[model samples]
Target: MLVSKYFKLNRSQATLDFLDIHIDKDIPVFVDPTSLRSLKTEWGHHCVSLLQNYFSCVLSAIRKGDDERAKTLLSCLNERNEFHLGYSKKKSRGHALGPASADEIWKSLSKSKAATTGLLTDLEDAVLFVDGVGPDMLSDAVCNIIRGPLIEYTQNACLYYEIPMEKEVSSGPVWNAHLERWEQSLIELPLARGAPIILIPKVVVRAKQSYNSNEYYRHYLMPVLQKHHKDTNSSLVHVLKGKKNKGEKRVYKTDLYELYGADKLASAKLTVAHPSALTNYRDAKKSTQAPPLDHTALAKLENIPNPDFPALLNEATKLRPGSKDAYLYEDAIEKFISGFLYPSLSFPVKQDGIHDGRKRIDITYVNSAKSGFFEWLSRHYAASHIFVECKNYGKEVGNPEVDQLAGRFSPSRGQVGILIARSVADKNLLLQRCKDTAADGRGFIIFLDDIDLRELIGQRYDVISGDSNHLLYKRFKALIS
Candidate 1:
């Protein structure tokens, strides 16, 4: 529904069909009717249902490029909001209120009270904080914060990414140097108010810097900038940034950016940029200066159709276009059971997904902390292993499925039928049967997509590795030797 309204597409047909397969719908989508707080896990991530809204918001901003407005919209968003977006200054009746002037707006959105406050009395009186970062040729992922939201300004003064909220902040010599160099770097830029992104191949990240600094750079700074490129997801990048200030010895570590092509970092096609540092360099009064506006792409993003929640749910069951249906959803249950709860049961997902696999599996990885596969046989099959069954349908596997697994296994190798289903409603009786049978044996209905699978395992292909033995390590380590 929100997607259709913002992107100006027909709501019913506007599916998030990114990949080729029609069954790829398991990639999380945002469901608006629900809120984030209700579904937040112990880890505080938004529920899986809200992922679609998150994508909608980000996509809306990028495609529409209402630079100033987008900055305001994105800053105020958080996991608490279920990542549900559609925030625009136009809808805020209080946006024009006078009691709170622009002076207070910037401070409110500062490192502590991070959120986009729509009212800015004097956008011209802003100072864009930055470091002397060039293209990614230097920092790699180390100083990714510096390589921010896609920019148009080049003479090195690119249109910097907006500081959403100060999820975290650090201050010190090592950190203070980067910030100082950044502030100092800002003294030379043309824009003053917004956090205009500047690039330094190596921003000189300081590990010994305050934890506040590390958290800020990692969560807010990196995530904000990285959201620009989809490939940046899952990069557990470690910094190899600039040397310390004069007193500290210059560490000579190779930055990861050197490995990237400059062509990839180029994206002037989107937003605007301005690189002229404060020409009146020595004046502290200059942080109030503003750059001329590039009035070229100021048109508000056109509205598109957002999907209706009822239809989306119905479609996932029908196994239509982009429908994960039930197969992928069920496998996610196995991953969560095996990886998080039951280490013994945890294993990588099968790319081809699961059927009632009559034979052996294609891929299997063993955890090192546990014993080997052969050891399972020695333990007399008492190991907490269960046979997995992933069903991509609306109906439950019922007592029949449970009995089928029970029939196959001997007492030494006890078996449980982990039947995964899409909607829990249809599986009601079957699930009860599994529970009742638990006393005699262990078999249960996982009812997969009843909850968001992506919120459990992931949205992409994740593989598990079993080569944990010391001998295996020595053999692999020998290659380096």
Candidate 2:
């Protein structure tokens, strides 16, 4: 069972901000540290700092010849099956660093030329130069180092979804950057089948590791060899076989690899001589942005079909307003909105609390909009966070609804929101009320009734071409005009 299904959240992978991982088997995605470093969010910055601190500590231990400390640091990375990710063939038994593997890892790093010469600057660098360290191990090591932040994210998500968590579970090996050591704490954690569960943000994961030996060998190393052989007129250069380019000849790295057996140490030696290639590779990886898994990819991993949009809309529209199951309608609306405005808005916090729990916003999405209306709102209205209020009322949404959403806004939280309701008896009056709020410097609110929502839902494909926000733009225009 997937985490969403197990928790009865009634949400699919399409609408979730995190990967809805299965409890029994591992999903074939890995957390890419490069992606985290490339993020512009506060959470992304924090995760990067944690990873750098922990990895730096390990390097310091190795450089100082403190074998015990280095080994001890490595030993913290046990099999963390809670995440339920990676390439496990069956159950989620992680192949992370255990005691034996930790010793081997320490030995490899302690004797490595890359480690001594400062070539191995980050965890991703290990995949290029270190033996027995691949994408899976690198990802596991990162998860261990940044486990604290992941735990906090999981807790916040659980609170939003009303998923129950066990109190005082062990938080394993959180890196205390200030103190330069590891620490453990007892905290609340969700459990499944007698094991702990930690949620990973979708933004920080990729289908493949950003820095891999295969890509380095092909793109970086081969190009360097090609330049070197061309400069010296080395034996590796060969003439073209086809008549299209009769006299053309080029240095082929494949022939060189055949000669040197495609060894990492040989490639590392070449990198040491011509370091610009490695620098170029790192620079490229740093700039490239890897998108999170889409709805179709998420469904494939869960062995399910794509989200039925028409069915989702039908379910939301059919629910009786103000009934005992009104919450279901709220969930349905959230699903539609989340799926509808994704990539533009993400990390939706359902029923987000404010003013120390005095009030709650129905759904709050982090403004990750790179282009289009949400991005425009961010620039003009300071909408770093987009607040949403879901009203399942059968009557017209009035001042109270607008006022409620406005109350949740502030200088830090943002001043823009979307009000989703079943119906509005007078949308122009509601828009006038919203306009009044905007005029008073309180906030800006846009109302989306079922009809408007249907329109938005129909234009969901426009999100890709940056056109899906036209409906929202129209509604927002009425508020200001």
Candidate 3:
């Protein structure tokens, strides 16, 4: 009975009698070689992407307004869909208002009057503008139907991004009416605090037949298993499971999923410390239920006794609790750019991340050569600085971080918003660069190291406020000024 609870197909007589339900004759089911039932349609893949964006927008507060504030946000959402401006190329940029990325578009939508979960039930009016659709079709329409309102509610409902109040996705007020309840939950967690999180199914049952087999197991299944090894060197079954469980441990890898009855795993006993535990803690399925079954489900997995690198780092530091070092961001930026940019640039660097919170400065010097930094400065004024940041814990150094930090824009601060990495990855700066806020990537972040920074020991000149807005370079004011 326990085995049959897991969504399975009945192919045999005994198995059929286990539950005394003859599904084979009454309800015909088709199974491919992999043995798992296929979803209603493949539309799930495309639509799910759009829906995830909507949910994320609603769940985050740092990015509060969506569909509400900015008129240009509509253009950003058009990227993933065949959505058009319905006008000529000349008119395309007309809708290109202030919204930056899809996320930012969500923020603008959140502020709209129509951004609510209840509003989603009104599928008719909303569907008119949607690209392709009918009552029954294999289109991304369903996603759009639910998305518009979610964005509305995110702006209208959620006080913060991370703490959502709704229990689950269904047709109800929890998605809309309970917005205030959701807002209060963010006191502890926030959207800016989000790190990489994922949910991985521990066990899978493949259906029979080439199409179902290849589609279900290979398409959806293998990729996740492969992902388990992205940062590690071992296979899912090998390194992930740790020790062995040869006792009454039930195995489901088989030719026919009939091995599992309808009541099998669908209602199996919670198995914490079994073989379904979330790993790297990134895959945990947390909940606010009075008694969270998901957490109990997570306990099912028997974690490998030990893991190296990040796991070791996690144990040693248990980081991400409070604030992070203000200067650690520079290291990540250097590492990322070293491999990312085409024909990337390189340089020697140092860190001064740790602080006593005693009004210590974030940066001291950069290669003040009158050539790259100072040369441009001399042409205009007298300045020598490439990228320097001041990691302020308060509001924002708005100008310095946004203007000269990133180096991407003509007159950007520091050329990057390099936030100091304390326990979190990049807690200092928000990802999107809001032009309304600051142009050159929001308050460019740069983290200090454990030791005092001494990257540029001896430089010819000093940083000077350059020709404010150089045509092609930054104008620095010489320190000798």
Candidate 4:
């Protein structure tokens, strides 16, 4: 439910649907290179930066004795108290400060005594020493904030394809980067193994709580830290946590000791790695052979209503070239792909691009389906994310058309694309050009005309027969090869 809520909040309906299919069918979701890159570079980096700013602002306010500003920032974290890093019904509050009044917070701050100074006049010092706004509270806030997005990203990765969590070992000496020591314990989500990793900066650890004591941290964060703590070649070295102060930038450890005192500082545990350290090991472990298609599910998918392709084609034929009515062809092709080719595929956005917005990708599909022969063909060509270009032209598709489709190919967007046209006179030449692109390592292009489109629609019901889709794929493969 947390995973569902997270996706509902951040992802589009198409992405939500893609995740739903995997959860309902209990199949692995396949994440393509493009999606993975976006998750790590764009989403991951943005989350880390936001959290760092929040931490810096709160810590700075506390250090400078700005109680009002600190309270305001602390409330931002408290608002999301209902959710934690992991999905569970048992309400473990973790380190979130409860909904106590500002008066109660200030009163506690006034009554509190500093761990080193004995008693404190400054309300900020009292607040730091008191129960609600101490180092532990700050650590927990960082953990909870980081956990929400980290778990969501991990769940999305799992939906992209099923990568099993590393099994827990009964007894092993695990390295604690924060403590700079090794201890004998059950090594959970060991970094030496093949699980995803998220690094937590040592500056964020408030109290030295064991990793497993907190349900969310144990389930979500520990595994990632365990897997990469000792790897020298790991990206952990390049993170913001690992960086040293060059000039005027405040040193994290020194600031904590100066503000929180030596006694309180002794309790803090830290790691010098960015909180969003993620390395996708899914591709290295991807199966060369795809799992078999579920015919029952396919049959059920076929029952879902789709546009009348025959009618769409007739309407498309009647519409003049460059007419806005021709846009119906894109809709028809989208339906054809979703209904006939793969149910997991959904068009999330149209005309997607960056900068000048000169290039508009006609249709982009987020393919989450792991079953079906066509799905296998896509996986075979390493195209988990698919791009489709639809043309309503009555003329033959030329090299220029083929080149446009090929231009969209990348390791992230996928090295395969589909070009749909009303017809083509030089089919051989187009096929030859596609082959040339494939040989050049740019991408593989498939051309579909009116005849192929009709054939796909006609065979939509034949998926129950199991071999009909395979035969169709073979025909397409032969044409392109």
How many steric clashes between backbone atoms does each model show?
Answer: 52, 0, 106, 12
Question: TM-score for model 3?
Answer: 0.18
**Candidate 3 Cα misplacement greater than 4 A, ranges:** 1-142, 149-252, 261-481
**How accurate locally is residue 69 in candidate 4, as Cα lDDT from 0 to 100?**
67
- Candidate 2 deviant stretches above 4 angstroms: 232-249, 258-261, 321-329, 357-359, 369-381, 432-443, 477-481
For model 3, what is the alpha-carbon lDDT of residue 36? 13
TM-score of 1: 0.22
- Model 4: per-residue lDDT, tens digit, 1-481? 2233323433222222232221212111121112222232344455555454544554555556777765655544442322232222244233444445433454444333332233322222322234445433544444444544444444444433233334453322222223322244433221212222322211111122221112322333234443554343343333344346433222233433343343312221111132321111123223332322333332243232234457545544555544364677775555456444444454335666733576777877665544555456555676766788989877877879888887887777677677888877887777777777777777877777777776665766453234545435654465456
Worst-scoring 10-residue span by lDDT in model 1: 17-26
Residue 397 deviation, candidate 2, in Å? 3.4
By TM-score, the best candidate is: 2
Candidate 1 Cα misplacement greater than 4 A, ranges: 1-383, 407-414, 424-428, 442-449, 452-481
Best by lDDT: 2
Candidate structures ordered by lDDT, highest first = 2, 4, 1, 3
Measured by TM-score, how close is model 2 to the native structure?
0.88
Residue 52 of model 1: what lDDT? Answer: 30
**Which runs in model 4 stand beyond 4 Å of their true positions?**
1-318, 321-326, 354-358, 461-472, 479-481
lDDT of 2 by residue, 326-346 (tens): 678878877877776766778
lDDT of 1: 0.27
Tens-digit lDDT track for model 3 on 116-193?
A: 322221222122111221221111222222333333323322231122333322221112222321111212111111
